[model samples]
Target: MKRFTLRTGIRWKITIAIAAVGALITLALSLVVHSAARVSMLESARETQLDRVQYISRNAEAGRKPPMGAKLNDPELPQELRDKARSGRRGTYVQEKPRGLPEVWAAVPLGNGQVLSLHSQFRESANMMRDLDRALAIGSLAVVIGGSALGVLIGGQISRRLRQAAAAAGKVALGDPDVRVRDAVGGVVRDETDDLARAVDAMADALQQRLEAERRVTADIAHELRTPVTGLLTAAELLPPGRPTELVRDRAQAMRVLVEDVLEVARLDSASERAELQDVALGEFVARRVSALMPEASVRIVADEIVSTDPRRLERILGNLLANAGRYGKPPVQVDVEGRVVRVRDHGPGFPEALLREGPSRFRTGSTDRAGVGHGLGLTIAEGQARVLGARLTFRNVAGPGGTDREGAAAGAVAVLWLPEHAPTTTGSFPVIGVP
Candidate 1:
């Protein structure tokens, strides 16, 4: 089963933030401006209407007909303004009609139990406001859109530079010595992203230099030890046969193996090692190797698919695993081959916490309260060889009735080797077998 997630990139996040802020600001300003404009326009209309009502009052006092749009004691005048006129106080009101322009009214007392009132529908102010509202709305939208576009431009540059730095770091981790981060503006170093790029490039350079020095020292030590170790082996062989002679031979052999392992590590570190690929019956190959290493171990062939890989490297990996299990792990060791995968298990204390977490490191044997521990080169060599074969090697502890708890030793350790299925292979399948 697979799960998928929707990942929102930094560019979109920044754009949305900027657009939202811009929209809020624009809305606030639009409301303020519209309120101020409407108030100013209505106030001006009220002043003009008051002047007309005063003129009509003077005309009635002079015994002449009132002007158009003006009436003495009009029935349609708003009650609030009419009450103010009856109390001898001038008043003004703005009426919002359902259709047409808004009506502005002004009233004055005539002192004869009558009132002079004038009204006008201020169409110019209403139309001006309608036009202003349209302009503000369009302007607000444009601001938000423009801000979003600017945000994308800036955010995209940052995101792209970060992706480049991340990709370069990944290649460096995968043992690519020549990868370097490139800044957005080539050599400018303009911003934090540029700084990050420069920092990554510097780190990669330092790492490559350190690794080269380490490999040189390892190769030098191994080459220096080869001659004397070989001479010592020859001398031990020529000595008289006894318990003392056997001890000398064994120690000398161990030293020779150590030197050879160091040399192999140097080669793998140099990144120039190549695999010799050939088709192999996986089950038969594994069976033979297992028999040679630990005759008492069991082998189970489940799929037995023929695979293409380097036989020498494959055998080296398996041999190291078998030797490690037999030395430190309690047996009933088992090897299971299924398709392009091989799993080796030992019913012993599982690998130490450090080993499982950090994988194998040269000369660092993660031994606990177990029987014995090796020099730690075996698993390291095995892992390097798997890399050369383009395969994945992983370690785990199997849980079951026999498995140990945290306070106790683990039940068993399992090492899995997953071979590449896309490798070229020959035509036939190998027979499955369960050997005890």
Candidate 2:
């Protein structure tokens, strides 16, 4: 259980707020009621004592003596009362805890040069005040406890609803277009939270629609250009074997590659790609793929763990990563496989800040020195392929050892692929990864 603090959570804040307000109101009411009751009880006791003193004085004038339970010449009489009686006027005084009783004393002057005093024990009124105090205390406590509990309930409901909407928004931000926030507190009780949920759902729907339209446009463009690209390739092949022909052939091949990448991206967007899973030793699979796709790169297998995955999709991901490293990074590109993780490190200027931050976009090359080097679709396709294989792809910059660089700057870029050991069985769809 966490201790409650103002900063702990919205629920605790709400609880404390309600408890504080309730306590203040209870305290105020208790003070008002207690003060009024104490004053009224004390006044009534004094009036009764005064009336008894007057009656006793009247009796003394008629030659009547003190009553059976009355005390004459009481030693506990206050001097103030005696002085008032000596002046031939009625007087009253209160003695707290006199003779084991809280008593109100009143006195009157007798015509025969004597004084008559009457006192009333206020024990019953004192007990009533004490009981009132106890009730007020108990009522204040109940108000605080009940108010706090109610605050927790209301705050928890609001927080839970907000969390649900936030989680759905997170999924949307991560490229999961199918996510929607459920109407937890449905119709007729709607408020701002419901409005926020509705807005988030609408935004996700709009994003999904826009992405679908873009995918359709890409697929259509790629489909329409395939025949023309094939014709260009064939025409270049028929040209005489010369420098001009080689140039034409190279350009044609480049165009073909770009078209293929665009088509693959469209398929990924449309969720048309499917994975074919198989059990394979992670170390061996990585070794084979690196040798075939990037024979020049160094390989180090620290652990051999078998993982259930799609081999072809895995190859596609690794191939693109290796190609990117070879084209843009410095020499000594290294591939390390340990357990279910595969990391490719290149001793080049680490990935550009923008590239690492915003991710790869088609045709936006990160290398300024080698401008127009290659289409930026390599990493984009690799990321999409990794997702299909139920793996995560991440990139970061790694710094070299101390004093290695003259300016002491970062060493290179590192791309990591985390493949889970046990892949869940999917029927016919490629599972979206790196998204919520």
Candidate 3:
């Protein structure tokens, strides 16, 4: 059997804690006040009994006796008080009953060998004490209830503000750079929560400004290099066909490819690229594109589905994935299309741990070869294009039969792309073909 418990949110927990503390303090104060009042009232009753006894003793000494209703010399006097009178010592004692008011007895000795007693019933004082106790009990209960209600109200307000700030932070984490906690939590009275919201807003602003600056610099650099790269390409193409000429042509072509890749990356970073979606059969599109770009790779269409997406961007994403598989992986690169999802699997040693963790970056290579690794812009451009089409791209290392590393671990790299079934299209599409 599972143990039962009371589960509560922060609001209730805070409210209960504050109310409990208030209740304890109120109870302590009430007890102290009640005790002090009881002591003072009891002392006053004792003094009144003492005064009555003194007056009766004086009258007896003047040869007069207490009046009939005074209860002086009553037969019901306690033995302790009677004995003190017989010994000629003045004394007082209290007499108690089970269900009624108590009586105070005072005794004194007469000069003629007789004892005198005086007593007073404490009916009025006992009733007053009972009423006082009732009031204290009711007042203590009221204080506890009122304090708890106030605590709940204050705690609810605080909890609501905190939840608003948390939601804004969640949106910020999900790439909504414009989300701000200040709008939700800001108020005229500045508090710690407001300070936290302001700090979050300031951090987001700084991050956005830095990113914009970096994008502008990248775009400007790419634009300046394009002219010189074009001239170099033309000169290399005009050279005579020879060993040295071939080397120059190849190097110039590589440089041109790099320049174009940089321009494409800059365009993506600046959000200048848009998708031009069209209704197309996904299976036929994948087959034709794979045949045209990577004829050596095997293609399998599991279940076809009509999807609305940018055909050119789709081709770029698939082409880059295929090229990376062929470059870094063994033969038999497999392309599988199921519904709106595509899976490209390469039976290689799998992606390096760093590449999987950090995604892709320009000019960073993960190939084991020390030389001739292409600038690492293929996956970077592919991922950026996927984002433009509102698609998701994920990479993982899967276990494959007979494919193992030197340590005898089976592994292969799998890149999966998921396109939305009904993607919205715009007027323009970004072309990423031949980008390095």
For all predicted structures, in order, the TM-scores are 0.82, 0.84, 0.68
lDDT of each: 0.87, 0.83, 0.81
RMSD of each: 6.9, 4.9, 7.9
| Clashing residue pairs found in predicted model 3 | none
lDDT of 3 by residue, 1-436 (tens): 9999988777888778977887898789878988898778767877777777778778878978576645556788899988888888888787887888778777777787777777778878878888988888888888878888887877777778889999998876545666799898755666788888999889888876897788788778878888988888788888888999889888888887887887788777766577977889999999999999999889999999998888999999999999899988777889999999999998777876667788888888775631158888888999989988978898888765654344324366889999965464563333444757
Q: Could you give candidate 1's per-residue lDDT for residues 159-260 as a string of tens digits?
A: 777777788778778786666676323534477777777787787788888999999999999999999999999999999999999999999999999999
Model 2 worst lDDT run, 10 consecutive residues: 401-410
Error of 2 at 226 (Å): 2.1
Better of 1 and 3 by lDDT: 1
Best-fitting candidate, measured by lDDT?
1
Question: Candidate 3: minimum summed lDDT over ten consecutive residues — where?
Answer: 424-433
List, residue by residue over 52-96, the lDDT tens digit for candidate 2: 878877877887778954566677688989888888888788877
In angstroms, give how far residue 273 of model 1 lies from its true place.
Answer: 1.2
> How many pairs of residues in model 2 come into backbone collision?
0
Stronger candidate by TM-score (2 vs 3): 2
**Error of model 1, residue 364, in angstroms:** 1.6
Ranking by TM-score: 2, 1, 3
